[model samples]
Target: MTAARAWWARIPDPVVDLVVVAVAVVDVLVSLEDSSRLAQAMAALACAALLARRRFPLPVFLLTLPASLMLDIVFAPFAALFTLAERSRDRRLLVVCAVLFAVASATPWPLDDLSSHDRTWTLVYFFYTLATAAAPVLLGQLVQARRDLARRLEEIEEAREHERLLHSQAVLARERAQLAREMHDVVSHQVSLIAVQAGALQVAARDPDFKEGARTIRSLSVDTLDELRHMVTLLRASGGRATELTPQPTLADLHKLVTTSGIDAELTGELPPDVSTTAQRTIYRTVQEALTNVRKHAPGATAVVRLWHADDGDAFGVTVTNTPPARPSLPLPGSRQGLIGLRERAELLDGTFASGPTGEGGYEVTLHIPTQSG
Candidate 1:
């Protein structure tokens, strides 16, 4: 029953009005038992008035009352009453309209022939008709209530979805704040100490080679501390920056990064100036991670940082290759997430990342992104 009503409700308003008018015409024709020309004209007007019931329900209903009184008709007045009941919020007005309909339906026309008993029967019939008139009003009110409920439920669902999104964002912000604190308090402090110790070692060392190594360590430690402070600041900003922070590394900064990597590394090749900031960041991180891996696992290896664009003009990328370690490398703590992260970044840009050992006992990391990717 509910499904059927839903289907019925989906019918267009104009179409429903036409159907009602047609039904009322059929009802009038069925009851038009040799009525006078005036009665016929009133019946036609009542059926026509049903067409405008949705817009002027009260006036249309009043127009139908005269036809109901002079002739035995039902549908035109009922449709108009239902429409008025669906739209009107005044209960008293609805009650009055119902009473009027009942009176029109019960009272006999042409007041020349009447008796006391006939008047009593007419009063009883009026009450019965009043009760019957309540059916359409109640049904129309039910439809109105159902529509209001559906609209209210939609609003509640939207509010809940918005609240859930806000809660998730709050949780993410808290996590970022905690991570920033840990990096600032622990990692930054330790790196600062390493820089200080390396500086002391560089000044005290007698051997030229030892002095150079200490100086390199101090420089790298200082750079790491600078980067750590920047990261901490960004995380603590809670995803909104009050001012422009330090600029991120791009291909232009690649030269400085390769030179300070504490290895015999060479930077080469060039890409289009139009590469997106996100793509540039991805390339920079790829080179940074590749060099870090070489410093830890391939000690004393010479690395070649080559940026290139495909001849077909479809893609551009970088390749970082390192020769085999000249000596055994020291064991370093690592999470092994660098390659996985690089792969994910490439995937996001609809690109490709590959890392493997070369036949010449060297390691190579390559990244290629489409020219259109951002």
Candidate 2:
């Protein structure tokens, strides 16, 4: 099917003229014995010119008329008219050409002379002239209509195909989100029970060693719970639920984030309370993604989390820089879209986010969010 389509597409317009030349050429050659050499030469020229009538429709079409001085140009005139009407959108020019051919068709020829006869024969000649001349316009209009209909159908099918692809992507995204919700529910339940048992162990322990172990276990379980909750928040916010609380974090939440992550961090500058909710969420997510990377990829790194407000109070942002980890540890691979998502979020809000390694062998993530109208 594909090969057949390719072959048809490669076939050019001029190929159709070969059949046209054959029909007109036979008429011109048969009249050679009776006509003058000049008349036969002119007829041959007019018929040969029909081969390129589509390329120059009006000029070649006119060449085949009364001025050819021989009756042999034949059906080529009608073919040229069809090509003109099929290709050009100018109705006035087609009408003028049709009128010219009709006028020329009334002239008497040796093969089919009728104008030299009585009233009844003249009427027959004129009827034949108009019928032959009108054939092309009728055929061209039909071809043009079918071509237009085919083009419209192709465009509609292409649009439907694109819509189907997008729907499939949406379905896959929903399935992944459902699976994440189920995993988090089961894991969270187990973690909560561990934390509760560790709390009881801490209360009953007498030996210093056992007391310290119980306390450490409870602390580790609490940190795990926090991380689990953050993951669940992200999953639901993206797909199903938690939309109302998804952007709840503000500039004020950075202090607790730093403490819980066990990073030796320093906080500096004023965090403006009046920042817009969307900008705040982007700001919070930027630091959160950066800190998450630091913990996973740059373990034990000290981070400096800074927030600064513009003097006009219309802009506020945060920058978090973390030193390279003291000792490297193998970290599991993660979805690498965090930085890309942060950049897109910031740009959507007419803000900016920049991240890269610093000269001091640390990674830095910086964001500037414009909150007020200019």
Candidate 3:
């Protein structure tokens, strides 16, 4: 039944209107036999009026009443009534139109010739016609309701999709904010240290060349810090959630980090003390993120954090490896963006970051960066 209604709805409006007019004309023709010329003229006018029913439903319906009173016919008036019912929302007006249709259908033409018996039959037929008229009104109302329901459903679906998009945008904004905070904490600490050390070297150096180099390093480090601070401030002002910026960890803090980590871990190996402050911070973060992952995904695991430099002192990095978990790990909520941030940090320093499961059912994370001279 629904498929049939859908197919009927697919018909073009003009085509549907033409079909209604044609059907009304046929109804009038069938009723024209043995009718007076005046009745024929009224029937023709009623059929013609149906062509304009969609634009002027009440007027067309009124026109059909004269023919209905003069001749025996059903299509023209019923079609006009259905159109009016579908478009009109006033129940009182629809009821009045239906009653008018019933009366026009029931009344006899040339009223002076009516007998008492005929009058009784006319009253009975009036009730029957009114009852039948309800069919078109009811059907028209159903169509109107169905159309409204479809439009409302479309609106609801669009609203849900819009909500989902907003939620995704909110998540992305939060992630970017967290990234900014991490950058400010780590980068600001390293650059500030560089400026301090350079200033010290510039003051103590005896040779003119060494003094000039130290002065240049101090100036560049200070400028870089200023730019970095401004950028971070802008990011926070735009939309980042309020957060405290704390002192960043460096190589010196590794021992405390490993000891406090919930996992059993060993820290070993050392690099030259002259390694750049930026490099030291990157090594620190690598170990931090790796140990955090072990505690979350590899519970009861023993980890090894090894810091190393190349034989020629041209490159240096840290490697953190953890054995398979000795106990079941608990489910924990995480953003899963720690590694991505680590990778981005490595890229900024022309370094490499890698992490994956080892052959012994363990996990390994490694960071490699070129050494920078102080």
Candidate 4:
């Protein structure tokens, strides 16, 4: 049955119609002595009409049914016509074709010479032929329906797979952007600190009282390099592995972060560990970026760093504001990715971050990160 359906699907309607004509011709040849040549010719013509079944099914059925009835009297070969009608999607035409077939099969030709047994056998032959003709048409319809359903299912699966691939690519792009921002923030701040301290070391080359300052500068450089290495390692790890970002600078390191920028600053706050870590990093980077901006574009500007924590233990905030020099002219050093990185870090910990010019000849950055005790 499977193989037959497969074959039927491939066979065009015109080819199937030609096959039906061949079958009709063979039937006429077998019954030539009993049926007239003219009657056989008519049956062949009726079979030929079925070629139009796909394009004009109702007209084909109408022409073939009556012709089948007329030819049945001579050779009783109307069964093929009934089969074509059944294959048609129009069921009303199939019913009409069935009625005509029944009439043609039962009607007796040259009745004067026919006997009772001959009539009964002829009626039985007609009924059997009609049933055989209808079988394939019904089966073809079922097969076509199944093929349609399978095609639709394949399309749906392809669409779903496309959507999944798009979603994965979008996630990967977001992660890459976030990583870029983090690198910019870390590298820019550390480089700015090194530059400022290097200048201080050069100015105090022969002064013993400034030896401690030189040592601090050397220690910060080594620590900065270590942090840079850690960031690089984190970037290399893949497949959702926990990133080994450096032990993030917290409130404890805020003093060093401010002093390294050559900024005279003060800090005050009773900060929780989690909030303090997130806030400290955010503040350090913000202040570092701001002070770097000051040194590059507004040299000789003084800056103030403020740390505030609420006693209710709900929130911690840090603000860094810096004034511009009288002759501010140097272009800002580093890309603007630092503030973006700060905002992303704050958001990752469900915190808030803001930065802008204070409209008082200086820039200000504010960060607030919430904390919970374990």
For each candidate in the order shown, give its overall lDDT on alpha carbons.
0.88, 0.74, 0.85, 0.61
| lDDT per residue as tens, model 4, 71-175 | 543222343443454345566666566656666655665445667798788778778766755654456556445654565455446545755997896677568
RMSD of each: 24.8, 19.5, 25.0, 25.6
lDDT tens readout by residue for model 2, 156-245:
465457559968867765875786677587988899889999999999999989999999999999999999888876777655555674
Output the lDDT of residue 75, model 3: 90
Q: List candidate 3 stretches off by more than 4 Å.
A: 1-10, 207-220, 237-374
- Please write out the lDDT profile of model 3 over residues 1-374, one tens digit for every residue: 87997898899998988999899888888888888998998888888888899899999999999899988899999999999988877778889989999999999985677788999999999999999999999888877667655654554465467669978877876776776787699998899999999999999999999999999999999999999887776666443455344344678899999998766999999988887767777888889889978876776689999988899988888999999986445455679799999998898899899999999999999999887632
What's the distance in Å from true for residue 5, model 3?
A: 6.7
Of 2 and 4, which scores higher on lDDT?
A: 2
Q: Clashing residue pairs, candidate 2?
A: none
Give the candidate number with the greatest lDDT. 1
TM-scores for every candidate against the unseen true structure = 0.62, 0.52, 0.58, 0.41
On TM-score, the leading prediction is 1
